[model samples]
Target: MNRLFDIFRNKYFLSTAAFAVWMLFFDKNDMLSQYEYRTEVHKLQQEKDFYEIETAKVKKDLNELNTNLNTAEKFAREKYFMKKDNEDVFVIIREDAKD
Candidate 1:
């Protein structure tokens, strides 16, 4: 008990404990702020990873469209509903289909 009380009474120990408490709870960038920052970084990293995958898919599509005339035409017809001047475009929609 005496040793514990002496340890607590030491000025250096008290100052160090006070500093740790301040840094953990009262400083400009505290524990909560650090956690929030880390969470935000994680979320941004996920978003970046998702976008990179999407970008790769888009780039692959673009390359295919550039290299193959048939693929380009298919993409245009499917995405834009494009047709030749004399061709008829028929769109079939199922009643049970969902958007």
Candidate 2:
């Protein structure tokens, strides 16, 4: 008991314990920062996955449009409202029955 008390009362041991507590709770590279960075990394990974899926869809569409003229023309006409000369274009709007 005396030896333990002597060690606990030592200045070096007290300083070391205080430093460890400060480092664990108040340091720059603490647990909170690690959790925050992990959350940010997970969010970025989700965004990357979404963008990759979108890129793959676009590439597939591009490949289809490159090989199929009818698909290309249909996409152009639907997306851009493009039409050939002497073509009669009609716009049909459907109102939802619930609305």
Candidate 3:
């Protein structure tokens, strides 16, 4: 009984147990790293969702352009500042009132 208790309470055993606890809970590759990795994964998922929505919108616009000449011309004029020949275009710039 005394030998068993001595083995259980020995300095080497205690130090090894403490080291294991430290490595499992406080080391560089532990719970904190897992939490950080989860956060990064969530951020990437959100970005992917946002890009998917934007891609859907672009695809819808592209499909519309294929079948709609008026929409295509409007998109080209608004986005690319295109104008017909012999047509005059005026641009109005708004200025902030507060200095």
Per-residue accuracy of model 2 over 1-88 as CA lDDT, tens digit each: 9999999999999999999988878999887888899999999999999999999999999999999999999999987889999997
Candidate 3, superposed: residue stretches over 4 Å from native: 1-28, 91-99
TM-score winner between candidates 1 and 2: 1
Q: Assess every candidate by TM-score.
A: 0.80, 0.69, 0.67
Worst 10 residues of 2 by lDDT: 90-99
Off by over 4 Å in 2: 1-16, 85-99
The alpha-carbon deviation from the true structure for residue 16 of candidate 3, after best TM-score superposition, in angstroms, is 9.0
Candidate 3 versus truth, CA RMSD in Å, comes to: 5.1
- Against the unseen true structure, what C-alpha lDDT does each candidate score? 0.98, 0.93, 0.92
TM-score of 3: 0.67
lDDT of 3 by residue, 1-99 (tens): 999999989999999999988887999888778889999999999999999999999999999999999999999888778899998767777998996
Winner by lDDT between candidate 3 and candidate 2 = 2
- Best-to-worst TM-score order: 1, 2, 3
Count clashing residue pairs per candidate: 0, 0, 0
Tell me which residue pairs clash in candidate 3.
none
